[model samples]
Target: MVFQARCEYGMRMTSAPDPFHIQEELKYLRLHITNFLSYQSAVLDLADLVALVGPNATGKSNAVAAIKLLREIPIHGLPIAIARRGGFDQLRHRSSGRPYNPALRLDFQFGDNPVSFYELKLRGMEGKRYEVKQERGVLHFKGDKYAFTNNAGTLGFTEMEGGHRSRVSGDRKIPVPAGQSAVSFPATFGLFIVARVLQLMQTVEINPALVGELQEPSSTREFEPDGSNTASVFEELTSETRAELVDELSAIVPGIQRIELRRLADKVTLAFVQELSEGKRREFLAKQMSDGTLRAFSILLSMLQESRPALLVIEEPEIAIHLGALRTLVDIMRQQSETTQVLITTHSADIIDTIDIDALRVVWSEDGASRIAPVAEHTREPVRQGLITPGQLLRSDSLDPASA
Candidate 1:
């Protein structure tokens, strides 16, 4: 909860907007991964809305997995995050029968502030053990730059003083667990930006599997990543938000008259109302709704939350949904991206066509290594000239990345 306290202090001292407020903008600009998963090296020049289109096994999901891991670092520490994904050896990129260490770098910008960055490198030790090779963060506030670093187990801090960057206040030995990151330090030594970075990252949420399953309502109002708590979250929404949600859902699914939160004694669930002939209506419980309907509802609910995350990653959102509904989903996602950085991985041609050309990054493999880049000029030309649509190009397996 260090970041939580620091977040409140930061807003009070600077009189800045709350970081979680939907109107505030704090977003990731780029993500660079080296020797992680199947990607020997890959870079995603993130935009407000980005679509990763590629053939299966081409490493689209790997890119998402990398970001998800970073999001969990501050929450679970470095060791457990790695363990949750198997282990360091399994995550490291392998070549020629040897595993290589993996490194991750993320660039972020908040409002008009200077671009800040956090970089992490994990080293593999003998006997399959792993340690934090390096963890660093730099944040610029007002006119001063604050830098924090942990080279191996040595924790250090530096700041801009009198116009020149120097190790001010000398170095102090800080005890940081070998398996933890320096960014998760309990006392940030007034380097609020360091805590801010962790706070921002902790807000990241990824789409969960089986998004449509019925849930036992709880008091927690926030949308859970797996969407199991969706009914409770929906019940907490303001009447205006509920109306807006229904309007959008009706556009996407049609015949969706409204959605109601039904509570029976100690149990709570959702009731999807559909209009029928002569102003008649039919009601379907959460368990009775189709998978596609439930999935769409869950996704829409996540995007409509009053407190949006810094980053949202969704994989293959088009699955089990009709083409028409997919279009509406894409539109809503695009609008939501204005408030949060939205990254999606999909093989759906309809998806490629709905997104802007500049928002598309094509993932492909070369010599068994994953590579990603904007659509190649040559490959994107036909779509640009209106001779071929992105959907058509995707279907033909011709969505190639531009040459470096």
Candidate 2:
């Protein structure tokens, strides 16, 4: 039940519109994993559109989480919140002991005319504050190579072919210390390319259908990780655009029509105004819509309208959606993939049943080791015959069989 699929390699994907520009070719990105969950070893070339499915706890979300964590590290990798959460000790595989022996590593290759490759090895150490034990950073491009200019806990670089890179700390020349990830070292001295790549690789794009956002209140504004921004976003739309969106949305979602955002005595809230025949009206305040319906709309709007992002990870989308919405969600998901590489962890058989089987990778976890297996028609038989539903299978005991 653990999805494991070997990441296909030795192939080239023509570049996409530059992610930096709305219409320019998005830079083609290749997300590869040599050894990851349910895969004795696996590597996957994420395409513009792809889908993944497996039983609950079979490690479906874990795969997406792994990718999310990787992209987040160089940025917020060292946030104080992590330390508060039991420090770096809690960062590694919970099952694996100190040293986090089998650390996950990611290799990146970018550019053209010359081409280049960079690798990041994540090593966790034993200490009150979990620190990185080793990081070997290098750049190979234009028939020349440079080593990780090392500094105190950071990785750095200098003139490879007389071209000055981004500046680091202290001076206009020096390598990064070993203590910090070369990817995250401040861009004062020089490691600019690495800096740019890390900057560009900021967020993980999630499959729209499965993405969820819960409402949270705060004095300040923030991008809701779960995407609770639809009503807020709609409130700002032009009257014409707002009307079109609501009209189309209500047609698909049923239960009447119209939506209004109110600034009440102290806070902002959404109101769903429904009209039965002949002006027979009803108002299901944001407080009135089912948690699931509100969540569904928020998820749909965010995915359908996001301007740009580094990556997106959609967790089990089938949870709250009806069968009819499932198909509509799929249509939009594939359309977005044309410009963004979206990853999804889902369990809805109805959704996957209609997808290209090869697009999915079943995942399984055991003894802290995760494996990814490609879902062949044959593989689905066991999952189908377990005579089980996703709800029951996810909560099953005896799942961590040590050597899955």
Candidate 3:
């Protein structure tokens, strides 16, 4: 039996009705980090395809982790998410001797609409407990700005409704609970939208070790972060979609005839069918496939997913990938960026060379704090003279701020 794909917002389809067509909306505008992890203060301007390249331990992964932490807050609450990362002490920057407040300020704009901003600040209190220092949100629409909610100091909650300002909780200051966010209040509709957008943000740290493992069949439509449920997801795709994926894979890796998902009474697994030199056919289980083949297949499945996230953050995608296939992988990612925003971290020159200079950001450390700058700012002469590519400058350490 063949299944039909369901089209939704931010999803790419071969053909669909008018109702399924929607313009690409910008979900994230900017991300500001202050005293969070290795960053003292830095702002990253988001784009369709963002690539972060730097030496190891220079806080490339930390930037991705910050987004993951923020994404978890609206779903799991604030305190639980902080505790999962070794508590507040570990999250705040330790370079300064004095106590610090770690904050994340995110700006969001949908389509051509006015921009909206949300800021969350946290500081360690007595008994090693963390509390919200200041929580505020604003929505700018139709030449007017609306402040959703502000919680700070002795002030309880100042909310704006229909362009009117009113204070809630009267004279007594209502403290936000340790595990909650002020913007998470259900009464504020604008603030709730911010929370919902954050909830939709997804991060994936692909692990090649888990990609080839067999597992129980699942009805999940989206690919998991670790790629463990790839077989199940492929089994659920439409016939047309599966054929398209097989064709793409065959082009990337020659001699591949087709990919099949085998189902038993208790388990489901993936089998790669290939054609030999004599036209002989052979099959290999997922675990029996090469690492590069398995990784490539998993990445291809993820890019072709019909129900992809609004923002997809992938860490070190170049790992376990063949050098010859890097160009194909880059092209696939660039094509998918039109529908879903893609952010990736890499140390591979081949991958970097394939990306535009405007899409690349250089991450480095200086004065015990991690910093990021656009590649255009660092390699102006080399880029103008066509002396070296961004990847070459990065490999030669010319993009490092400390070196400048």
Candidate 4:
């Protein structure tokens, strides 16, 4: 009866909130990787807005892939996440004389409390597959503590009233499937902290190519990572937010007057209304829009959503974007970072120039492995002193991590 009341008013409810609104109290601090892609071992310190800058093959994309992997684990479970990346064999680094297993650790903080962490280690098995070698996590939030550990598929969980692990009735031993993570298992005991951690791990990876595809109608209002459901998502925004989005898009594209959602049969798509002249108007379907227009529109829509993800990762968003619009794009990202962490991988000098030196992290190759760190003090000093832009330093190869 309650659900029917909401349905009559066009409200949608689910087992969990759609388009999870990341709590502002939670913030990611660091990402540690081992034997993943070009990284033999690396730690990236995260800021609200991180601009991952480097030459090609420096492992910028690898870092982004790692975060995406973490995001998938909670939703798709461990085995599928591994399979989606072509199995563990392809993901493990091929460095000579080093361990073949790949591991990842993410550190996060809830407000000013002690840091919380989740770690996962995988071991290669026969048939070019992998199994969970070990997994553990400790989370302290709102006066409740939850901790879980899984060693070789043996799972243990504890819930307590304080930060220290207290042996409560929830403490129990079980065997998780070799291919699963206890934290990702829906029926795990003491799942409050694990669920909160995974909720904050929610991430969206925007692909302009996917965002440009034609969309079909759906009842869901949640924005997807690849933005395939953009038209429907945009259609659900409140009128005030839609107005703001249209105004922002017009500023970026110079002629866009409004955005209209069109539906035909089961198909749904966006149409851009442009005022060609004082009395002349033109309409273009999303298919007819320029790549730059589509890309910018997708980004703005994500930023304007009522509920935002914990992390927004965009790879080479500069592609197909006008140089003049780069500042506008960066500005929106900066504003969005106040509510959601933004991570971008790019080689665009304009993007580097638009962001601050503190937000810059340089990725480079050292000893045939990728290493990442904050920009060198030398390069940072010049940029901070206003002697030259970070973009100039990037073009001259002065932002190399080796010099740090």
Candidate 5:
């Protein structure tokens, strides 16, 4: 008997037949923003691992917030999501006493096929209401393209294939209500790819304190953004997976023997077993563990989950962790990026040191708006000459366009 192995983004192939095949899919491509938060207009070409770096209040978190809001659109609908964030006025950027409409454009690709793009523009209307000024969806594949545009009270769709053009005419006009996305309409066909892509994007804002709290045991495999169900999720992992996590945790922090999820009466909590001297072991409850330890555990669990999202946005992962553990954490993030795209915001020089310059996006403020640039392009000479690490360039303020 022979076992056939399948290759995945992060898994290692062992004892498998024909392991050279590559499964490449475009999960996320590019994000363009205009008049959104502090960005008048900015575009980010997302990679597997992206590190956003800059000083405080430079809109690092704002970028994450934009993605988060976009993630909410498919679920809660555009109007409700905008309303939850204090309406369109607050979501849009106001500069120089001029009212600016907010716009977002996303590009997604599906497994070596041509790219699909979604563009949405929102404007504040009379009586504190907001309207979707323009919405468009385009899909290009194999020299053929399908596109639809909804603007100025009219909706139209076009299909171009083999140099022939056809319009969706004669009662084919889809009626997309104001403040709604055309992709969300049930009548729309061939746009499920865009919807599926949006569904896979996730933003995680972990709170270490939440990890310490008692949680009800559940069979959930997906970890929440706040890490509220970390203990329950840990309980769901198989023994082999749990052991792997323990090994990773021990590697990052010495003296950790094992992790146990114990259910007490009606509550479940995590316990960390530390190997004591003289061949003894001591157990510490989640509350007794250090902040850094709990935070590290949350991050490790998120990365090691069997079922994960396509894109994971983590904000400020360097908080409360020991500097010595930054390398291990960075390594875990990089490894996880092989399977899932990771976007991280950090102010730690140590975290920046472990990242490649190409993975670094220098975020800064210019003229009351936030801007982002690739670190290599922003700091050309020093990076090209190998004279400075990204960490060093950050500390020396060489990545700041305003300073230059």
Candidate 6:
């Protein structure tokens, strides 16, 4: 029912460890983007909070799409992933009267001063072979590390001296064809603990079409991208957490008092209803919730899983959420951000108005580049006056025209 823009994102590190328990680390998403037809350059420093607001077709979704593009490469085969989303030609933008550079690079910071950087130059594929024009990855530890690439043979370190570096490389760089991503190679064996946090927290995607099967609550099932398992997730919650979630959800769906996640007849299912109602709140197969309710449930539930993700990427968090519930949605999201880096993209002025003035970024597509810049200056007065809402400021001239 909601025709929303599509989005994509990524997260990964060298070791495989959940972020909640790691105490001595910091995670961030920084990009030095260029080569699009516009000659426009942007270094989007995604930190504690970042927001991009712009009009339709302004590339707000495109940037998010790139991130998801990167993530899907690892989860599903890249070809299938791309096709499922929109296909290759759709991936590139028509710019500068011609396509500019299609290169991409990312630098990830971890620990004290250690950093890991990956860069890839994407080009057209010839038949089944998409020759690599240039590719490189580096690990900086103790101020010294190794570098590897398809072009520049190993200069210093090829494999991590202490860990299994070769296996990581084979999966990340070896088999990926051109016009694709290496880190997203699911077949790739390495899952760095740090990288996974950022990646897992990367943008979230939901397919509304999948809602049909999610009508009922699913206690034993994992959360579906579409959020069909929301009722079940709450059903499985401890009494305390369930109370909290119910309190929160009640703010949105008037009757939704409690959701039960239970396994009966050897099957996991979700059960729920208006806190004030008597009969079945509603029986959904997990696919039956209103698009809006399901989307909200997805956001709330996903937060519980992170415990603490270095970065949390949310695509169109505003979709399906009622304008009235926008404030509560932002409040909970901010609460989650206290422990995880949060980045969201939305067109709703209401959603934008609630964001702290200092924590805003506006993304756009002009000329050819997908660019993002701080909207801090734009948000100052409104924040001080406490007049316009965060969401309003985000959508007003206070933000980019696309945002306005």
Evaluated at residue 246, the lDDT of candidate 1 is 93
- Write model 2 residue lDDT over 144-186, tens digit each, in one string: 3444543345434443432444322223333443334554543
Off by over 4 Å in 4: 1-15, 18-22, 97-99, 163-166, 188-192, 199-213, 402-404
Q: Ten consecutive residues with minimal summed lDDT in candidate 4?
A: 1-10
Candidate 6 lDDT (Cα, 0 to 1): 0.55
Candidate 3 lDDT by residue in tens digits, 32-67: 989988999988778888998888998888888788
Candidate 5 backbone clash number: 0
* Full candidate order by lDDT, most accurate first: 4, 5, 1, 3, 6, 2
Q: Candidate 3 versus the native: TM-score? A: 0.83
Question: On residues 135-226, what C-alpha lDDT tens digit does candidate 5 reach at each position?
Answer: 88886644456677878435676655635664433235656666776555423333433444564677777787888988877665678888
Model 1: runs farther than 4 Å from truth?
A: 1-23, 160-170, 189-213, 264-266
Best by TM-score: 4
User: On a 0 to 1 TM-score scale, where does candidate 6 land against the true structure?
Assistant: 0.72
Which scores greater on lDDT, model 1 or model 2?
Answer: 1
Point out the higher-scoring one by TM-score: 3 or 5. 5
Model 5: residue 17 alpha-carbon error in angstroms = 27
**Which portions of model 6 show Cα errors greater than 4 Å?**
1-26, 35-41, 77-85, 125-129, 140-146, 152-198, 207-222, 228-243, 262-269, 277-290, 306-310, 376-382, 385-404
lDDT score for residue 331 of model 3? 83
- Per-residue lDDT of candidate 1, residues 1-404 (tens digit): 11211222112222133443423646678989999998898899988899999889989988987876886665566677788878888899987777898999988776776888888998989988988898888765544566778889876766664356554543555656677776554335324454444444322233334444455776655567667777787877889999999998888888898888887667677899998667889998877777778778888887776545566777788877899999989999898788767888898899888998778998988877889999888877777788988889888877767874
Error of 2 at 133 (Å): 4.3
Kindly report which residue pairs in candidate 5 clash with one another.
none
* Candidate 2 weakest lDDT stretch, 10 residues: 1-10
| Regions of model 3 farther than 4 Å from truth | 1-23, 96-99, 140-146, 150-176, 183-187, 376-378, 400-404
Better candidate number, 1 or 4, judged by TM-score: 4
